[model samples]
Target: MLGLIKKDLLIIKNNIKFAIIFIVVFVCFTEQSSELLYFVPIFLSTMLFISTFSYDDYNKWDAYACTLPQGKKSVVKAKYLASLLLTLMAVLITLILGFIIGAINKNFDAKEMLEIISGVVVAIVLLQSIMFPLMYKYGVEKGRIGIFLGVFGMSGLIGFLFKYLNIKIPNNVIQTFNDYWFIILPIIVILMILVSYNISKKIYLKKEF
Candidate 1:
């Protein structure tokens, strides 16, 4: 399983320009505050997860993977795991770069770091809830619409809620994320992903290989 994941990561490492832009934007913005930095991981994860399906289509590797002893379910699980791993690495890079930029300017703080981490976590959960099922149901070509809609619709709602609605949400979501339910939150995310994986595997399992 780990070998399969490494193989998948190596494939993605081949085209990292998209990942590069996220870092570039992080530096260009100059704020390097957690609020601004949080979005980097969120955005990177979704784009790359969607690509999980796209790459499979582009390379026509599904047939090849299906022939492996671990079977189709493991192939699908490997993709999800690879996405999570890459997403974590991306988040780490963003944090390290953000920290450097912040230190250079002497502007970084702990609460801000919490906010960034919370924002990324929330974004990952929301994205997986929307995209994973769509990818399972529609595959990449048809499912990109769902991704666009999920991405844009959330963007608009956030704009309206914060910009126009003026329904101010306290920073507690970030400030005290680990204070009470932090452990449960990740467990829930893992369970959700597992559930999604089971469903996706069941769906793809029946498809002609």
Candidate 2:
């Protein structure tokens, strides 16, 4: 498991320049928008995690790795674990960046920061819940398309519902979530990730190669 994780890390290390560029662009553009800035770390982490799939596909690593002792289940678990690790790292980085920005601007809101972090965590988990199964079932190229369509389709549907149906989320509901998110959200995210991992593992087990 550790070796598998190390392999993914080496892949990321090989592509560190792209990660650096992404962080630079995110920091520059999002400095003024705290809400959007909150998403930067998780977004980068998720993107980096997905890029590892592309690397494995390009290098034909998956087929070769399955021949080794760790096997497909370990591979799937490694990816999921790597995603969790990267997300945590990203969250930490965002916290530090938030502190620096708040210190500079002298406009810190702990409640808002907590809300943003919670939102990012939920978003990343939801994305992975959709993405990993597709990637395992269809491989990276098709999975990337699935991810694009899934995200935009969901966003468009939500927008349409909001615009035409006038479906509004109540403030109290948001407040309830914000109040109990530290307790509720982590449990929800963990359950969702576990389900996603099981689905991915099943898909990977059935995959020939």
Candidate number with greatest lDDT? 2
CA displacement after TM-score superposition, residue 188 of candidate 2 (Å)? 1.8
lDDT of all the models against the reference? 0.73, 0.86
Q: Which pairs clash in model 2?
A: none
Candidate 2 ranges with C-alpha deviation above 4 Å: 25-32, 161-175
Write model 1 residue lDDT over 70-175, tens digit each, in one string.
Answer: 8676877787788788777767776786677767878777577766675677568667766776776787777778888879998999888889879876788666
- What's the CA error at residue 150 for candidate 1, in Å? 5.2
Residue 159 local lDDT, model 2: 99
Q: Once superposed on the true structure, which residue ranges of model 1 sit more than 4 Å away at CA?
A: 31-34, 149-181
Give per-residue CA lDDT, model 2, range 1-209, as digits (tens).
99998888777778778777877887777767677777877887788888999888888899999988976769999988888888898899888888888878788887799788988889889998999899889889899899999999999999999999999999999999868879889999999999999999888888887
